[model samples]
Target: MITTRVVKILYVLALIPISLFSLLMAVYGLAWIDDSAAFGYLLLLASPFVWLFQVFATRIVLEFVINQFKISEYLRAIKDKG
Candidate 1:
């Protein structure tokens, strides 16, 4: 759950580009902006894959942090002691 929380946070953080591009898309759709449509569409198409990569990447990073920070060891110790 903890790792998942971290992953969710990181995943949401990773969505910044998508959100920004969504806003840009909205603007383009409304004809308030014209020059950014292609770029917006590019990001729109790429963002899901990018976020998927971010989720996996965040998991890897969190796994490293758990080991490097000894959080998993502490958890195991607690479970054993209990």
Candidate 2:
């Protein structure tokens, strides 16, 4: 469970690249950029959905890990008591 929290923190930290890339792209207009570059710039500019998606992904992963850890701990306690 503790490790899972650390993982979640790392996931959040991963967003930093996305944010920085987006800001950089936004500073330079996509119109003058090449198509692929423009696309990347646009993607960065329009990445609110990406951020939201990451949030949901992190939540689901954390929830599953926490639940699994709790279940395993519970089972271990039961086995120890028995």
Candidate 3:
């Protein structure tokens, strides 16, 4: 069984890259503002939505992983009982 501390650490690890990528995207978009106004506006506007979708997807994946672990733990318990 995975401990709560380990799960928390995994969650944080998973979020780190995502958060960094989002920040980078925002920065890049800001930098582009001087070159192309329309494109820069698009990126700036889309960055938040992209970040949100990424976060949502990550959450779903992490939940699935955690559920798999829980299911396996439960199966193990059942096997031991029987």
Candidate 4:
């Protein structure tokens, strides 16, 4: 329960950068999609890498924030709950 709150907090915080990256990428990449089919296909091909980067970055950031907080207590409490 405690770490649930912690994770939600970290997830919301992490969304800030991820969403900004998405918006920025969309703004710049949309031009390529509108200009030609080839560039649009290229964007499609590169989409997976973009998703991987965002997920990896968000995980790393969430882990970092978790470590910075009193997560050990929550972990212990969770273990006791089980």
User: What is the TM-score of each predicted model, taking all chains together?
Assistant: 0.40, 0.55, 0.82, 0.49
lDDT of 4 by residue, 1-82 (tens): 3665878777788767776776566555666777886776576666556766887877887777667665777788899999
Model 1 / residue 27 / CA error / Å: 8.4
Lowest-lDDT window of 10 residues in candidate 2?
24-33
The list of candidate 1 runs beyond 4 A from truth reads 1-36, 69-82
Better of 1 and 4 by lDDT: 4
CA-lDDT, candidates in order: 0.63, 0.69, 0.83, 0.71
Q: Rank the candidates by TM-score, best first.
A: 3, 2, 4, 1
Among these predicted structures, which one has the highest TM-score? 3
lDDT for each residue of candidate 2 in 24-50, tens digit (9 for 90 to 100)? 545554553565776766665665666
Residue 56 of model 2 has an lDDT of 74
Question: Candidate 3's residue-wise lDDT over 1-82, tens digit each?
Answer: 5554676687788788888888888888899999998888888888888888988887787778788888889999999999
What ranking emerges by lDDT with the best candidate at the front? 3, 4, 2, 1
Instruction: Tell me the lDDT of model 1 at 69.
Output: 50
Off by over 4 Å in 4: 1-4, 8-35, 70-82
